[model samples]
Target: MNLNPDQITNYANTFIKVLIDYSPKLISAFIILFAGLYIIRLINRFIRSIMVKRNLDPTLTRFLADILLWVLRVVLFVSFISKLGIETSSFVAILGAMGLAVGLSLQGSLSNFAGGMLIILFKPFQVGNTIEAQGVTGTVCEIQIFVTKLITANNQTIFIPNGSLSNGNIINYSLQNFRRADLTIAISYETDIKKVKEIITAVLANNPKVLKIPAAEVSVKNLTDSAIQLAVRPWATNEDFWGVYADTLENCKQAFDAQGIVIQPYVRESSKSSS
Candidate 1:
C-alpha cells in the first residue's frame, strides 16, 4: 500500500507536535535525575562521615550507606518517570505489593537483620569480647547482618541468630575493667572458721593478680552436716580473672593442706544407715 502525500505530511506534523509538547519535561527530568544523583552522593558522604565520627562499625556503616543510596535512587527514578507523563500510582502500588510479599517470605531473616542493626547500634558486645548469651559463653568473633559468630574456649565456632541474641540476656565479661571471681571452698565442720578466713585472705593478698583496693572477701556461705561452704570472692582485672580464680583455688588448697585443714566428705544419711 502506498501513502498519499497528505498522509505523510499529517504524520510528520503529529510527530513534531508530540516532541514540542514533551521536550521541556524530558529536559527537566534529565536535569533532576543528574541533580538528584549528585545530592544522593553528598548525603551518603555526609552520613558516612557522621558514622565514622561516632565510631560505628565499618561493616555497618557501609551497609547502611548502600541501603540509603538505593532507596534514594528508587525515589528519584519514580519522580523521573512521573515527569515523563507516565502514571506512577500503579507503579508504586506494584512495588509496595512486591515488597510485602518478599518481606513476608523473609520474615525471620528480616527480623535477624533488624536485630543485627540494633546490636551494631547499641554495641552490647563487640568482636573479641567475651560474652555469655543464649546459654553459650564465648568470645564474639564476627558480627554479621543476620548472625553473630562466636569462638568457644574449646575452639568451637558457634553461629547465633541475631534476633534471639539481641533479645536475650547478654553477660559481657570484658565490658568492665575488673571482674569479681567467686569461688567456693568446703572444709570440715571441725575446722576453725576464723583461721580459715584468715588463710584465704592471706592467699588472695599474696596473689599478684588479685586487686588490693576493694580487698578480697572470705566468709562462710553455708553450713552442711559435715562441712562449711566458704565463699571466696576476689577482684581481678578482666584479663586476669581466670588466672586469679585458678591460682586462688590451688593456693588455698595448698595452704589448707599445710595447716592440716581437712575437707570433710558428704556422707548421705541413707548411706550411713546402710553401713
Candidate 2:
C-alpha cells in the first residue's frame, strides 16, 4: 500500500501515455459517425430545398432524392467503419458479394428501373398523351420506376414494364401540335383520275376539323394491276386524329360514289382465278 515516489510517477505517466495513444482513434471514430449522420441530413435538406424552390415534379424529385441519400449513407457508413479500425477490403468484398447476389435476383427490376430513369430524363412521352408502344396503343396515365400505366380509349388500364417501353419504339401522338389523317382510296383505272381527285379534295374541304394552313394534299401515289391508289393526307389537331380518320374514309366513299368515281378491290385476284 505504500508506493515509492518513482513508482507513483511511473503509474501516472503510463496512464497518460495510454490515453494519448487512444484519444486520436476515439476522436476520429466520433467525427466520422457525426459527419456521416450530418451529411445525410444536409443532403436531404438540400434536395428538398432545391426541388421546392424550383417547383419540380414531386414524384421525380422524391425518387432522385431518395437515391442520392442512400448513396451518401453507404459512403458515410464505410468511412465510419474504417475509422473504427475495420479492414475495408474485407468489408468491401462482402458488400460486393451481397450486391451481386441482389443484383442478379433483381435483374428485371433493375432493367425496369433503368428504363424508367431514361424515360424521365428523355421524356419521350407524358401522362394524358396518346401513345403506341409495345404493340399496344393507349393514353399514358402514369410513369413509374417499375412500370408505365396506360388507359385505353375503352378505359382499360394496362401496365407495361419500363424495359419494354424504353427498348421498343413509341409513337407519341400528342407531342406534335398537329397530326396528319391519311386515307388511302384506290379507284379503277378506267375511272377518271381527275374526277376522283376532285371528289377527295371536296371531302377534305368540307371537313371543318381539318386544318388548312398545312395545306392538305391529294395525289396518286401508286398504280397497281387492279387500281390507282390515292393518298389523301389532311392536317388536324392530335385530339381529332381518330375522328378525322373515321370521317375522311366514310366521306370519301360517299362523295366518290356520287361523282361516279369507281373503287377498286382491296385484294386483287390472279388472272387465272379471274378467268
Model 2 C-alpha lDDT per residue in residues 1-275, reported as the tens digit of each score: 89999999999999999989978987988898897788789879898889989977655787888888888888888887788778999999999999999999999999999999888878899878899999889998899888999998899999999998999999999989899877788888788888788888888999998899898999999988888899999999987877888999999888877776667878756667554
Off by over 4 Å in 2: 1-46, 55-58, 72-93, 270-275
Per-residue C-alpha lDDT of model 1 across residues 1-275, encoded as one tens digit per residue: 89999999999999999999989999999999999999999999999999999988886898899899999999999999998889999999999999999999999999999999999889998898999999999999899999999999999999999999999999999988999898888888678989989999999989989999788888889887767899999999988999999999899889989999876666565554555
TM-score of each: 0.79, 0.73
Q: List the candidate 1 regions with Cα displacement exceeding 4 Å.
A: 1-39, 57-60, 83-85, 265-275
On lDDT, the candidate that comes out on top is 1
**Candidate 1 TM-score, C-alpha based:** 0.79
Worst 10 residues of 2 by lDDT: 266-275
Best by TM-score: 1
Per-candidate clash tally? 0, 0
Measured with C-alpha atoms, the lDDT of residue 83 in candidate 2 is: 84
